[model samples]
Target: VERRSASFALRMVVHIVGDVHQPLHAADGVDANHPGGDIGGNARRFLPDCNATNLHALWDSGGGRYSLHWVSTKPEWEAMRAALLRDARQMVQNRTAVAAMDPLRFASALETATWEEAVEALSMSGGFGLVRQMIGESAGIAESEVFVGLQMNPHSFGGPLPCPDAAYFANAASVSTQRIIVGGYRLSFFLRHIAARLRRQGLLVQGGDNVFFGVTNAWEAAPNAALH
Candidate 1:
């Protein structure tokens, strides 16, 4: 592959891994209340007052409005960005356990990720597994974190449901950040493992660069952005 293709591939892997960490990406949010299926909360609102107003958007954009969800306001957007990077950094440094997860799914995803199927199905299928145990893990988070506010009130699907409280955002942020941290760890591990195999076969150079998503330097870089 050309350098650009390789680099693009690497970037896509990093981006997709991050994308999957968003809880809603792994869940369809179907139940008796939502007979039509939540469609990853796209049809619903996050809260009666929250800008996103949809459960899926809430998790996808980090407590903000649509399109420019996190960018509704410059100051608030910057703050969210800073917090995201800071928390992700901390989790990356502390998420050593994630690397030990057996049979990372990136291999399979990567295999199919680049391929263009000749015959496209009417509807794509997805609802657990096939994501390096990520679907299973995220399902647990969706159950606990996303449905948390629901326990406080009586509503379902689209509605004037109560807004999630400060406590809820805190929990969501933590979960999202930690998942990204594990993502970086898994991505790093996958690349290194691949490179090592190539080196062993005398196909490439040794001691290749470790792809740093700025998490490793969080301590020295964003000391003020500590977990809250």
Candidate 2:
């Protein structure tokens, strides 16, 4: 692939992996109200007073704490970047507190997996096993945490949707935070794996201290370098 295409592919992988870490992304509600499915909770509305319009939006925004809006200006983008960095620092600092909330023990597995073990697993399963495990974990969380306390309206429309209590919001925030951290870790692993594969395939070359992937200049000099 061309340099730009490879970069875009990597970004898509990162984005999709991060999204899959969210419980709602891997699960949907199916009940008498809507037999087809809740479309990952998008069909179920939350109370008007809630920060999000629907169940999926609530978790997507990190329980209203990390709602993101368009940044049209450079200053706005800078501010958002700083805020994200701050939040990431805080999450890393308090990651241990959220460990108990991760029933799948992904953090532990990531920590213990050696390079050889990871490569072996990836080779054997073509990385599908890891992806499946992550999805399964998210689905389990969606069932036990996201869908457990929800009170569905008897009628699909014309009535106020059930409002999640403060406790639910708090728990959701914690779970979201944990998932974000896990997603970051997983993304890092995936990028490293991709880089290794590219190097092995002669698609990436080591230039000084930086690895250039099918590109002449340093990858850091690329316009989208800030994403890293």
Candidate 3:
């Protein structure tokens, strides 16, 4: 039960960490049309011609390439997984995309460091500081990139805004792809840090060719033990 709970918690943490790296998740557009705030652009609707109905949805979907859809069957799941892996590989292989995030410098540093070293490298903030820095960076991108050419009118009779131009879509796609790579790397850093701590506490063990979490030397004696 403890192992299952730990696995669930880790999955939630990874999901949330990836979400915060999305610029729209960290910012709300505020203009005369929405002095109260744009509710992260959800209040600002785009024309029907646009890929998404609102600015928030546009950024969330990466201009429709990442739009949400249901996948219930095993085959559907497998297909989605394969598509995701292919896209990830393609992004990693793209020199411009990988260079934008500097994965070699940022991800490699934390990924290679011990837990104590990571804490020291973060100036003792223990990863929270790094998460906050990521949020700030996303907010900056939201302002400069996401909200730059938005045309919000205060008196449009609740009508939708104009569809973003091709340039806007292009930039959004570029930024979203880079942020996705960075977020994945950041999540890896956190997982590696947690694994290091678990190893220190003897809750994780090096076995053959695998690192097993939520287990100790006598893990084989326990049934239904988590493997990671």
Candidate 4:
């Protein structure tokens, strides 16, 4: 079973922590297995102005693109990074062992708990806290790659969206396969957008590089997530 797979379990950790934080992820609007294929708001076109599919994708990504553009300049990056590192250090330093780790356990232990409950526990657990920490670490790498690439080859910002560039696409066979991976990509992209926005505001200057920003206002923007 998928739940039994180690990789699946790990992905579950990554997803669930973020998922439960999403209000819509916790709500009950669409069925997972349906003829309409409207799995968790990813499907279900709604109105003329809103694209549920697109909106849901944005929320899933955690506002990544927006954050990056806002925080693009040099001075912002330096300040944000310094603040983020200091905060990360202080947080980790004072954390208790129990508060800092949530070692992976066999799926059997999760049997009694609902998926939501397990996720909440993991979010509160030290290991999951470490997962949050790693977000900073990984974000640092992703941002550095983007920043250096931009400095060496600056692109003229001429688009509606304030992104460093346009977009990236991928393809896959089978609905399940497509949805499974696309979910991660969508979420990652939105987070980058959020980082870009924070950069613009200078709230996430240095920390922006380390912070994983993404859209998180799904419940407020339900109509938007239904298109396409």
What is the per-residue lDDT of model 3 for residues 1-228, given as tens digits with 9 covering 90 to 100? Answer: 254455576667656777877788899987777778889889999887777889888887775566466488899878876676666655555444543565234454574677777766544455545656777788988988999876677337567898888888888888887777666655555666765566665555454433354333221211111100
Clashing pairs in 1: 45-53, 45-54, 46-53, 46-54, 65-69
Estimate candidate 1's alpha-carbon lDDT, on a 0 to 1 scale: 0.52
Model 1 Cα lDDT, one tens digit per residue, 1-228: 443445466556556655666677777766666777778766555455665566776776554321344367889878877766565555545433544542444433442332222011101343333453665677677777777765333364445556677777777766755555555554553345434443454444323553323433322322222211
Candidate 3 lDDT for residue 94: 47
Question: Residue 88 deviation, candidate 4, in Å?
Answer: 9.1
Choose 1 or 3, whichever is better by lDDT: 3
TM-score of 3: 0.75
Cα lDDT of model 2 by residue, 154-195, tens digit: 444635477888888899988777678766655555556576
How close is each model in CA RMSD to the real structure?
8.8, 5.7, 7.2, 19.8
Quantify all predictions' global Cα lDDT against the true fold.
0.52, 0.67, 0.65, 0.32
TM-score of 2: 0.75
User: How high is the lDDT of residue 164 in model 2?
Assistant: 86
33, model 4: CA deviation in Å?
A: 18
| Candidate 2 off by > 4 Å | 93-128, 154-160, 200-228
Off by over 4 Å in 3: 93-100, 103-112, 117-128, 154-158, 199-228
Per-model TM values vs. the true structure: 0.58, 0.75, 0.75, 0.23
Off by over 4 Å in 1: 62-85, 94-132, 151-160, 194-228
